[model samples]
Structures are given as structure tokens and as C-alpha cells.
Target: MELTDLLAALVAADSVNPSLVPGGAGETEVAGVIDGWAREAGLESERLEETPGRPSVLVRARGTGGGRTLLLCGHIDTVNVEGMTDPHTPRIEGERLYGRGAYDMKGGVAAALIAARDASRLGLAGDVVVAAVADEEHASLGVQEALRNVSADAAVVTEPTELELAVAHKGFVWSEIEVTGRSAHGSRPHLGIDAILKMGAVLKELEQLDRSLADRTHPLLGRASVHASQIEGGVELSSYPAQCTLGLERRTLPGEAGPEIEAEIESLLERCRQADSEFQASHRTLLVREPFEIGQEQELVGLVAEAAAEVLPEPPKITGASYWADSAFIAAAGIPTVLFGPGGEGAHAVEEWVSLADTEAVARTLVALAARICA
Candidate 1:
């Protein structure tokens, strides 16, 4: 199938992440369609069910033996399309294909599927695996299951990178800090310890932390970062709230450890306590994904760069992605992984689209790279 048509079919299927939106349609239908497509292409295909109805499509072009494996991974599930108008309907205008997952990124998924099928037909020296996983918009349970089931020498996560070769990306740790205080009626200031007011001090400390992060930078990825994602406190206007919770995310560099993040939070809490003895707070790490980085000299990197130069009008611009991806998970498992994909805008926005030209170019590049490395 043509890359554009395949992407149209994919975008037509509903695959909103259930974790992000309750009662959301998931990857079950999409995975089934991909499986059938892979079978028609003569590739070995299967589904890995991580959650009850969330299945990941695994398609493989097996090697002749004694050769390496290249994994092309893309998420099947997209963020919720609540505000989108006809999000599942793919519309093509000139070189752009508009749809919810068109750029962020069922377009990349289609490219990978076609590339894997092409490699299989060529009978390459190494295997090429197209893994369309679920739950990437949420907890990434699908990629976790994929790691347990497959191994590869290297991987490319097709994650809407505007066709850049992203060798490094930030990983984030989710944390929650709860402030505790005594509740009392609005008239009784002395009787109530205001947790909401206490959180003000914590927020100030976080500002200092953010500045410190700004001073620390990586070559390709720029600086580490921290942000308060959510804050909730106070029950009613008539009373001082007993508790306030501040949700934070710390984006880590490649070598930063989880303990360092915990320590940073602890230090901030300690600073708050020093300023006000009445301040009471505690923090815990909710979740984490390790940052990914790889040297540009890796063989897989060279192959992709060479292929991209052949396929694209301009030489590939190598860089790092500010956002995290399943690439980190694959890189964590010791496989060299990079992010590469189609160009577009409006990820998680009301209107989304992908560049038809870039989508096809990425597929052709992957096909050429697979043939070069596997042969």
C-alpha cells in the first residue's frame, strides 16, 4: 500500500489512550488491521496483549541467521482527541495529511510497517522488526512487554521528529509533594496551620531548583528542567485546608539518577522547614523513565545518516528531542536507539497533521538503511 493510504487507514481507526481518557478506544482495532497488513506482506506477525484490550502489533522480517536485528518501534495509541473535529478522518491537502495521529504519529508507524515489509522482500542479512506498541501516551506498558519479548542490536522510534536523527532525549520523573496542616474555620487563624500558605514556600524553593537546573546543560539536549504540573489545595473558602498536593516533573539528563531527583526534593523540603518550623511536607517519586544518549559513531547511526542523505534533499540534521519517547526504554535495555520521523505540528492539539513528503521519505530511508545494514 502507499504510505499515504496506509496512514489514512491507520488514522481512521480509533486508538485513544484509555489511561489518558477513561472509556477511550484503544489499539485493539488498529493492531488487528496492522496484523492483517503484515500478513498480506508475508511477514511473521503477532499481537502482544499487555492490558486486557490493549494489544501491540509485532511484525518481523526474520534474518537468515548470524546477523543483527533492527527494531522499528512506534506507539499505536494516541493522546485523547476530545476537542478535535473529526479527528479520525484523514484529510490530505497538497503534501499534508491531517488527522489526530497523523504527526504524533501513525504516519511514522505506517512508514515503519512499509519499510519492514520491503526489507523482508529483499531477504536481508539481518532481521527488521516493526513493533507498534500501545500505552505510550500513558504508562508505556506495551513497550515494557515488547522489551520482554524482543531483543535488537539497535532501534529507531518513529516519534514525529520532523525527520531529524535524534540520538538523545530527556527522561522525566513524576513526583508529588503533599503539605500537611491543621484545618480551622476562616475566623480562626491561630487554630489553623494553612497548608496552602505553606505550599507557597515550597513553590519558592522550586523556583531556585529550576534556576539550578537551567545552569546545567547537555551538549545536544540543552538543560535539565523541572516544572509543577499540578497543584491542588483547600476544600472550601470558609476554612483553612488541611492538605495541599503539588505534582512535579523533573526532566533528567542521560546520566542523572533517580536518587538525585529525590535528594533535590528533600533539600527543597528541608529549606522550607528551616524557614518555617510549622511547615510540614513529604515527597515521593511516582514514576520515572531513564534518559537516552548514544554516540554518533555507532554503526546504526552511520547507516541511518547515510540512508537519509540519499533520501532527503538536504543532509539529515542530527539533534535531540526535548520530549521523551519509548526510545528511552529501548536504549535502557542496551540497544542503541534513535528517534526519527515525519514533520508536522499540533501534537495533542485540536488540529494535527503530518507532512506527506517527509513521511514517504522516512520510509524510503528506513528501507534503504535496513537493506544496507542487513545485507
Candidate 2:
């Protein structure tokens, strides 16, 4: 299938991640289409059911040489489209293709599939493995399974990058900090302690911790960053809240690990503990995504650069990813992987879209990339 049509079809399928689904974050509605495509291609494909509702698709083709293999990985599921104006319908306006997952990764999946398709057509030197993974927007299970079971020389993860080769990227530490206090009636304010007040004290310390990491920088990922993504506390205004919770996202550079960042966050909570004996805080470390550092000099990076040169008259930007993707899992699995795909800065933004011209070019680049990697 042509990349544009494939992307449009994929987008129209409504694969809103299970997390965002009403039942649970377990099933993807779009898995069947990808599986059908794999089966039709005569590839050895299977579904890895991580849980009852969540399943990931894996497909592999035969290679000629005993040479190393190349892996093409992409996520099959997408983020929730609940509040979207017209969730299931994908539209092409001007030079852009607008849809829910069009930019974030369905486009990447198409490019990767096309690359492997062309590779099989031309008969490359080594095998090309393609994985249309699931839960990438929520969990890393799809790529994680592929990394554990599949062996490959290198991997190319198709994530939106405006055709740049992402060599380095930051990992993240997700944590929730909760504070507890006594509840009292609004009329008797002195009888109850306010969790909201406790949060204010914690907030000041968090700001200090955030500022401290500001100057810390890596060559590609310039600096460490932090954000309080969400917060929730009391429901009633008349009662003193017993608890308040803050959802935090900390961006980590090459030197940091998830556990260590969690510990650092723990220390901040400790400081809050010191301020008042009643300022009790609990911590839940959600997920620790590790940072990736791949230079353009690496063989995989070189292959992508050459492929970009082949597809476009202007050179593709070679840089690191600021946002996390399946690349982290590929790197964690010991495969050197870099991200290359269609679209630009509008990823995950309002009315996200992928450029038609860029999509075609990315498809051709993937074809060239597979040829180079296989050889």
C-alpha cells in the first residue's frame, strides 16, 4: 500500500490506547488490520499477549546471508481520541494528512513497513524484522517484548522527526508525591490540617530542585528538565482536605538512571518531612525510561544519513530526540537504534498532521535504509 493511503487507513481504524479506552488500557482496536497485512505478506507473524487486553504484533522475514539483521519497530496503538472533534475520520488538507496518530507514529509505522517491503522486493543481504508494537504511548511492552526475543545488528525506529536521525534522547522519571493531613470542618479551621497547605510547602522545595537541574547539560540533550504535569486533592471546599497528590515528570540526561532520580525526588520529599512532623509524604515511582546516546558516527546512524541523502535533495537533520519513544527500549535491549520518520514539531499537538511529501520521502528513505542495513 502507498504510505499515504496506509496511514489514512490506519488512522481511520480508531486504535485509541486501552488506557484511554473506557474498559481498560488493554486492547487496541487497530491490531487486526496490521496482522492481516503481515499475514498477506507471507511473513512469520504472531501476537504477543502481554496481558488479557494488550497484545503486540511481531513479524519476521527470511534473510539470505548469515549476516547481521535489521529491525523495524513501530507502535500499533495510539493515544486517546476521546475529546477530539472528529475522532475516527482522517482528513487530508492541503499538503498535510491530519489524524490522531498520523504524526506521532502511524506515519512511522507505514514508513517502516514500506522499508521492509522494499527490502524483501529487492532481496537485501540480511533479514529485516518488522514489529508493529502496542502500548507505546502508555507502556513500553511492545518494543520491550521484541527487544527481549529478537536479535538484530541494528534497529530503525520510525518516530516523527522531520526526517532527522535522532542520535541522543533524554529518559524520564515519573513519580507521584502525596501529602497527608488531618481533616476538619471549615468552621473549625484549627481542628484540621490542610493538605493543600502542605503541598505549598512541598512546591517551594520542588521549585528549588528543578532550578538546580537547569544548568546540567549534555552535548546533544542540552539540559535536565522538570514539570508538575498534574495535581489533585480535595473534592469539597467546606472540608479540610486529608490528602493532595502531585504528578511529576523529570527529564534525565545520559548520566542519570530512573531509580536514582526517584531517590533524588525522595530526598525532596524528605525535606518536606523535616519542615513539619505532620507533613508526611508518600512516593510512587511510576516508570523509569532510560536515556539514549547514539552518535551520528555509529553504523546505524551512518546508514540513516546516507538514506536521507538518497531520498532528499537537501540533507536531513542529524540530531538527538528530546522526547522518549520506542528507541529507549531498543537501546535497553542492547540494540543500537535511532529514530527517523516523517512530520515535524506539531507531533502530539492540537490538530496534528504529517506532510504528504515528507511521508513519501520518508518511505523512500526507509527503502534505502533497509537496503543499506541489509547489505
Candidate 3:
């Protein structure tokens, strides 16, 4: 199938991943479409359901027996549309195909499927698998489910990497801190405790955490990070809040996992709790995506580098992904993985778009890499 048709079919399906598209049901419609497409193309495919009505699809073309198992991963979700009402439809306007998941990334998914089709047609000699899973925009439960079925020698998580070879990526952890206090009337001078005031130290210490972590650098991922994403507390306008909650993110690297970092943050909170017992504080881990990296010198990276340099007149940029992808899961499964995809900038925005030329180019490159690696 042409890349345009694949993208149009995908974008038009409205598979807004519930995580990115808050309140969205799932990408079941899109999964249904892809399921049919893969089956018709003579590829083996299945839709694995994590929860009822929440399903993910796995499609694979039979391998040439010897070299390696290549798993291609992409999410079937897009962030919810804010102001742009009909961002779901793919509209080709002046060399750009504009849609929600076009770049973040139905485009990547299309490219991988097309490349797998190309491999089957051209008789490339290795296993080519496509995992178009759900919840990548949220907790990544779909990918976690997929790992239960298939294991690969290596993987290419198809996140937008500007057509570059992504050898490393920082991990992401979502956490929340709750601070409690005694609610008091607004008119009272010292009758009730203010939760926000109690958390003043927590916020201050959170800032210190971000700063201290930023100062240290990694050779590839550079600085780790913490972001204060959300805060909520109190009900009435005039009453002192009894409780306050802060949502936070911590960017991680090879040295840490979710539980390990959770312990560190809890330790910090423990200290704060001891200093001021009135502000009893506790934290819970909302999400933990372990940080991972496969060195540039690995076989998979070298295979793509060689093919890309040969295919493109200019060298493909060698870079690390700042955002996490299913690559981490593959790496965690002991597969050497990389992030490689087409060029596009406004991913996850209302103005998101990907060039048709880039889509075709990435498809051909994936085809090349499969051929070389399998050979």
C-alpha cells in the first residue's frame, strides 16, 4: 500500500490512545483496520487485549531463518485535540499531511508496516515484526502486554527521531507527593493548618532536586530532569486546605529504575516529615519507565548507520532520544534497540504534520536495514 493510503487510513480511524487523548476510549478502531490490513497482506497478526475493548495488534512477516528477529514498535495513540476540533482527519495541504498522530506517530507506524510489506515483497531474509500497541501516551501497558508474546533479537521503536539513529534515551518516572494538614476557617488566624504552606518545603525541595540532578551530565543523555507537572488541593475558596498533591516527573538514566528512584524521593520526603511532623507527607509512583541505552557500537546501530549512509546523500544524524519510547521495553528484554524514523517537528501538537517524501524515504531505509541485518 502507498504510504499516503496507510496514513490516511490510520489517522481517519480515531484511535486516540486514552492516555494522550484523555477520556478517550482507545485505539480499537485503528487496531481493527491494521488487523485487516496485515492479514490481507499475508502477514501473521493478532490483537492482544489488555483490558476488555482495549486491545493491541502484533503483525509479523515470516523470517528467512538465521540472522535476527527485528521488532518494530509504534503507539496507536495521539494526544487529545485541544483547540483543533477535527485534527483527526488527514489533510494534505501544500506538501504536508496534517493530522494528530501523523508525526507522534501514525506516520512512524505506517512507515514500519510499509517497510515490512516491502521486505515481504522483495524477499528480505529476516523476521520483521510490527507492534502497534496502546497506552504509549499514558502508562505503556500495551507494550508490557506485547512482551509477554514475542521476544526479539533487537527492536526499532518508531518514534519520530528526525530520521536519525537514536542510540540512547532517558527514562521517565511519574510520581506524586501528598501533604496533609488540619483545615481551618479562612477567618481564623491560627486555628487550622494550611496544606500549601506545609508543602512549601516540598515544593522548595523538589526544585532543589531538579537543580541538583540537572547539574550532573551523561555522555549521551546529558542531564537528568524533574518536572512539576500538576498540583491540586483544597475545595472552598476561603478554607485552609486539608490536603495538597503535587504531580512530578523524574528523567532517569542507566543507573536507576522506578523503585530505586522512588525510594530516593521517599527518603527526601522522610527527611521533610521528620523535620516537621505536622506536615505528614507520603509519595506514590504513578509511572515508572526505566531509562535505557544500547551503545552506538552495537550491531543494530551499526547496521542502520551503514545502510542510511549508503542510502542518503548526507549522513543520518546520530543522536539520543530525550523522550522515552517502547525502545526501553525492548532493551529491558535484552534486545539491542534504536529509535529511527522520518523528519517532522510539530509532533503532539495541533499543527502536527509529516512530509510525504520523508515517509517514503524512511520506508525504504527500514527496508534496507532489514535486508542488511538479515543478510
Candidate 4:
């Protein structure tokens, strides 16, 4: 099948992450489709299902031996298509292929598959692995599973980057702050300690911290920051709220540690306690994905950039992404990793589409990269 057609087939499959949306179709169907295609293409393939009903597919173009293995990774699951019109039905308008996940990922997945097929014909000395991962939109379970079984010298996360080579991207940490207080009738102020009011102080401290973070910036990714995601406190109008909780997400930069962020939050809470003897608050880090940055001097970076220059009309931009990706996991596993993929728009939006021209260009570039790195 043609690359565009393969992408259309992938987009047509409903692979909404169940973790993001309740009862959503997981990566099973999409994984099956990819596995079937891999088998038909005569590529070695395997299905990874660490979590039931949420499977990932790994397709490999085997090499003769004695060279570094290169992994091309793309996620299979997509965000919900709540507001899209005929989202599962792929359509083409000029150079654009329109459908849910068309731009965000399926385009990249297709590019990797076709690139592996084409690159294998070169009979390179190294293997090319295509990882169609699952739940990247949520927890990145698929990539985590892939890493447990697959080892590679280097990896390219085929996330949509407009063909730019992304060497750095922000990571994130989720945390929750809970404040405790005494509940009493709303009519009696003296008898009640207002947890909500106490939470106000914590919010102020967080805001100040966020502002201070703006002063500390990364050259490629810019400043680290924090924002409140969800909050809940009051119960009923007639009662004083006994507890308040704030959920926040902190965007982290390279070299920032999750433990350090937790400590910082604890210090802020301590400050609140110092201000008011009754400021009883505690915080816990819920989740953390460390930031990813590969040095420009890495051989993989040079090879990918060279391939892009040859395949693209203009030299590709070397930059960073503002969003977190599965690249963090790949990098954490000790594999030098970077992000490169097709150009498009409307990722997780109502009108999602991938640039067909750019998709093909990305495939060509990946083929060229395999030749260089896997030689």
C-alpha cells in the first residue's frame, strides 16, 4: 500500500486512549492493523500487550549484523475526536490528509513503516525498528513497554515537528496540595478555620514561584513554569470547608529534578506555616516525566540533519518542542533520541490534517538517515 493510504487506514481505526476518555477504543485495533501490514511487507513484527486491550506493535527491518540498531517510534493512540466531523473517515484536500490523528501521529507512523521497508532494501549492517506505541496521549505506556523488550543504540521519535529536528523538549510533573482545617457552621467564623482561605496563600506562593521560574530559561526550550490544573475545596454553602486540594502541573526543564520540585513545594508550604502557625498543608508529586535533551554534537543528530538537508528543499530547523513526548522515556533508557517527523496542523483539534508532501519528505529523509546511521 501507498504511504498515504496506509496513513488513511490508521486514521480510520479508532485508537482513542481509554485512559484519556472513558471506554474509548484503545490501541488494539490500530496495533492489529500495523502488525498485519508489517507481516504483509515481510518485516519481522511483534505485538506488545503489557496492559490488556492496549497493545503496541513493533516492526523491524532486520540487518545482517555488526552495526548500531536504530529505532523509529510513533504512538498509535490518539486523543478523543469529540468535535470532529467524520473523524474516522480519512479525506484528502489537495496536499493535506484530513482525519483525527492524521497530523498528530498516524502520518509519522506511516512514514516510519515505509521508511523501514525502503531502507531494508539497502541491506544495511544495522536493524531498523518501527515502534507503533500506545497511550502516548496519556501515560506513554506503550513506549515504556517497548523499551523493556527492545534495545537500540539510538532512537527517533516520529512526532510531528514540521520536519524540524527536535533535540530538546519540556518535561512535566503533576502534584497535589492538600490543606486541612476544622469544619464548622458557616455562621461561626471563630469556630472554623477556613481551609479555602489558607489555600489562597498557597496559590499566591505558587504564582510567585511561577513568575520566578521565568527568569531561569533554557536556550532551546525556554523557561520552566507551573499552573494550577484542578482545584476543589468547599462542600456546602452552610458549612465551613474542612479541606481543600489543588492539582498543579509543573513544566520542567533539562536538569530539573522531580525531588527538587517537591522539596521546593514543601519549602513554600513551610513558608505558609511560618506566616500563620495554623497553615497546615502538604504536597505530593503525582507523576513525573523528565525532560529530554540530546547534545547537537551527537552523531545521530548530525546524521539526521544531513539526511533532512538532502531530502528537504531547505535545511531543516534544529529546535525544541514545548510539549512533552515519549522521547523522554526513550532517552531515559540510555538511547540517544531526537524528534523528527512530517509537517501538518490541528493536533488534537477539530480539523486535523497532515501535509502529504511533507510526510513523503520525512519518509525519504528517514530512509536516507537509515542508510547513513545503519551502514
Model 2 ranges with Cα > 4 A deviation: 23-29, 82-86, 184-192, 234-240, 344-346
Clashing pairs in 4: none
lDDT of 2 at 287: 80
Sorted on TM-score, best first, the list reads 4, 1, 3, 2
- Show model 3 residue runs off by greater than 4 Å: 19-25, 185-191, 235-240, 274-277
Against the hidden reference, what TM-scores do the models get? 0.97, 0.89, 0.91, 0.99
Which candidate achieves the best lDDT against the true structure? 4
In candidate 1 the C-alpha lDDT for residue 303 amounts to 86
| lDDT value, candidate 1, whole model | 0.91
Q: On residues 7-81, what C-alpha lDDT tens digit does candidate 1 reach at each position?
A: 999999999998899998999989988998888888899899957999998899987876788899999899989
Off by over 4 Å in 1: none
| lDDT computed for candidate 2 | 0.79
User: Cα RMSD for candidate 4?
Assistant: 0.8
> Per model, how many backbone clashes are there?
1, 3, 0, 0
Question: CA shift at 31, candidate 2, in angstroms?
Answer: 2.7
Give the C-alpha lDDT of model 3: 0.83
Error of 4 at 190 (Å): 1.9
Q: What is the C-alpha lDDT profile of model 4 across 327-366, one tens digit per residue?
A: 9999999999999998899998999999999999999999
| Model 3 poorest ten-residue lDDT run | 16-25
